[model samples]
Target: MPGSPNVLDLVHRSCTDVAAAHAEHVKIDDAAVSALAAELLQEREDVRAAVRGLPLPIKFSSLEQELTLLALYHLLDFGSGYDPLLTKTSGGRDARETLLFGLIGLHLGGTRMDHHKLKSFTMYDLYTTFNIEATQEVAVMPGVTMTKPGPLQPHAKALLTAINESGAALEEAGAKSPGELLLSLAEGLKKAGRTTAGAFVEELIDSLPGFRDSVLYDGRTLTLHRRAQNLAADLAIVYGGRDDRFAFSDVDQLAADSGATTIAVLRAKGVLQLSEELASTIDEGSELPAGPHERALRAAAVAACDRVVAAAAAQAAGSAEAAGPAAAAAGEEGEESGAAAGAGAAAAGAAAEAGKEGAGTGAGSTGPAPFRAVDVGAFLAFLTEEGRPLHGKITRHVTRDVTGY
Candidate 1:
């Protein structure tokens, strides 16, 4: 695999190249991206808190169980395109919320995270597990009624397929569960003296079919791999300090979540400019298939986020340098001022370090950190969802029957 392309490098390069190309359907605005990065830098603290607070409140019996459930949840993470239908079916819960609800239910319902059990799950089992209705009433003739597939049926089918495929693959690989598979991959990489998040992500992509979220655009393969990268980020955040297996050396190399939500947030903030046709199509709630327009939008989002991380990093370094002399001056005043300045300097140094490669908890840093592409992506997604009233209504582009996101 020496000649094989690095997945993370391909993700960054392909996205940057495509965004720079400025496809006919979508355009990335550099100024807007810079502005957004500044704003995100201002909000970096809140973003960090949100990301650190992502560990589920529920208690699992063991770390393996927790990881298995988390992996399964991410495996079934797709279905953004079915949000509206999921909302209606799940008592107003969105796609992610609905999926989380189902995951929690599965755990509480005594469903073990076994590969064989996953492969045996039927559509009906998925419906019950997600607490959605399986069939809908269809009025065929007058008062005569017949049953048809529910709105969530297709989403359920997609989930079933992903689950079965993953289960089969895991079983074939002798992995008892997704968590076991992750552990094996991590151990294998460690034995080979490779311990980067990109390595872990590539392992997942090579092992799991669902993690291969790439598309060909203009003869260039754009390796998005949104879910795989997210799983890496999540592991780094949730288990970095708690578990040695989750520590990744090069987590800063991880890109943002390459999904429609990121694209939607960028478009709403004018960081991503869309053509009249594409804008109208999305605004009208048309299904934007996986093609040129969709690829451009996602790739632009990826590139825009990379620029944001770089800008934020530069800004943090500048601030740290500016504060150095000020802190020195303050230290001359009194011991209390000196102590405060020391603390502030330490905080700034940590933030500056976060901007560099391998500067997170995964790399053994133990202080306040700065922004990364994953944090920016999460912040944008949070803005679209929780900050909707403040940021205005933002609708994610609808792409049905796709397992990428």
Candidate 2:
């Protein structure tokens, strides 16, 4: 009993701390409703419960760490948009109406670790990077102008501190591996902030190779992948395991089990392309090549080029048909008119063939052509035998850490 803190005591302490922080918070007017105040207290408990559910190891990059902290700051100030305690003083919809106060608090509270104000750092960093600051005035009507005020107030600052401390706590809990830790941290962050944290964790998880054979990471965007089991299920459908090498074979079994029609459509599109690539491989002497991935991509490219040629031919045929009727009407009275028309059509065909030949010769050609192929033998004359001169520039950008940005 001497060392134990009961649940009631813990709840009272949290309420007291939040109430004190709320009192100290500076605002233009009394906008946060009593219901919202109560909801904030409830949110704290919910987030704490969510954190406890997370796995032991919690891992995250510094950028993710920063975002996690920012998310907590938002939640503490905004209450997840659903505080039921406001049944009495309720007229407005939600806490979003009081968002400016929340923003102001976060900006003023600044960094908990460094005790650096958010306004000072964000403005200073922005100015240093882009030669612009939030305070800089922009022209308005007549004499009116505006500029950002200084750092956030005490209440907002306290919320920011709480966020940073929670992140530090998660880091201290340490997990079995970087991946496990990341997942745990993500789950914890989700309790505090919701979808924002969920998405970050999902993207990181999808990037792990043990989790998925292939991952799609579009820098500054999204990632997509299929896990090992899901992949196996798909394989089971396609060829009934008759040929295990093909990815689609796995996908086919998955389609059967899941009743998904998309697998068939995708396979149909791929087969034509595969056929083209297979033909290319056969022409080069049926070895099937060493690199499956590269071969597949090349096959797709060849199929695309064929489609382009077919489309061009169709357009040419339609154009001649449209012109033929008009030409016949214009020359119905003469015999030599038919001969002249034939000559014009032959010339147009020759021109189209020449255009295709010229286009196939360009740098933009998707892959090697059917008749004429890429001349790999002339590579030394084009590329600097050692390397390109801009290699250093590219390396710097590719390896650059832009978190500071």
Candidate 3:
């Protein structure tokens, strides 16, 4: 199984390999990665707080409903290309938040969002549900205008395609909803002695076309599987320890959700150095078509985030080791000494385990959760969000024609 070609492995390997090969447009800076990783390590509490703040405010009637909403939310998590339009139309909510609020509104309005309901959704229904205006004014003659399909129409169409395709796949597999499908996959993987996040992702990609986020580059397939990987990570975060059904032994193996925002944050932090042409293109707010340049940026972000996690884990381990001697010496005084020694030992052990897991060995390690690339991604995402310190500095690369994000 170590050498097996799973989806997670493909994502990590292809991204790193392609990034190393295609450095002309985007270059990864090792020193910047180390510095950023150290900064994130020192701000671990902030990272955790940001991640904890991600869940929607709505209360679900059941785990099934929660899973369904989360799944649908991630499924349509794209449309960053329409972020400006979305912000203007939705009164300041970005693309991701808009989607979440829209889905929540649907649930509150008595829609179950089951596979059948998803399949039955029309374009008009989506426009209404997401609160996007259906038409835009197009200037035809001088001082005259005509109504045409809105700028967000393409994004709405893409969202519709993703949901309809996902629903069809789930229905074909005898799943009533996304939650049911995920539960079935988990149970089946457990029964087969292959209960890991990578396996879950592989199965999800195989089951749904919408999750197969890969492209052919230079005759080789470069896989990102951003939505699929995030779905697994989200499930682990939402259900870990609360429900055994979603416990993934190798949750630490997941890479960062490689998307436009991730790349932008990395670039802003100096981790990714883009060529003049690409930088101008992104800085000018132009749409980055899904091509070699865009793929290079995303792939570089994934690989750089992996390095960041590794560096952070190493720093944590070093700090723990440095404190171990003092802690052991403090244990020689009184009753509290024994507890201090035990805490030190536990901290050192956790740090070592975190280092191993952060290396991305795919060993089914259940290490300290904060040392994973997913956590690093969450931290960067939080920093770059609207009104955050890094918001004005980072220009998110926009790709309009793809639903992979």
Local distance difference test, each candidate: 0.77, 0.28, 0.79
Cα lDDT tens digits for candidate 2, 1-405? 223432222222332232223222211111222222122222322311221111213333453343333333222332211212221122332222233333333334552322122213343442332221223354577799766432222223333344344334334454322324444544554454532312332333333222222211222111112222222222222222343222221111110000001111112223222244443543343333223322222222222222332233334344445555555554674776777666656645543443343112121234222111111101111122237432212100010111100
TM-score each candidate. 0.86, 0.18, 0.87
Off by over 4 Å in 3: 1-4, 48-50, 137-147, 320-370
lDDT of 1: 0.77
Question: Which candidate, 1 or 2, would have the higher lDDT against the true structure?
Answer: 1
The whole-model C-alpha lDDT of candidate 3 against the native structure comes to: 0.79
Q: Rank order by lDDT, top first?
A: 3, 1, 2
lDDT of 2 at 357: 34
Worst 10 residues of 3 by lDDT: 360-369
| Residue-level lDDT for 343 in candidate 1 | 73
What is the C-alpha lDDT profile of model 1 across 233-275, one tens digit per residue?
A: 8888778877667788766677878788888888888888888
Error of 1 at 302 (Å): 0.7
For residues 1-405, write the lDDT of model 3, one tens digit per residue: 435687777788899889988898899998998899788866766764444424677788887787878778777888788888889997688888888888888989998788888888887788778876657899999999998988888888888889888889999999999978888888888788887888888888888778778898888999888888888887776676676667788766788878877888899889999999999999999888888998888888889988887667657767678767867776776686888877877777766654554344332222333467877787788887669889778798878878877
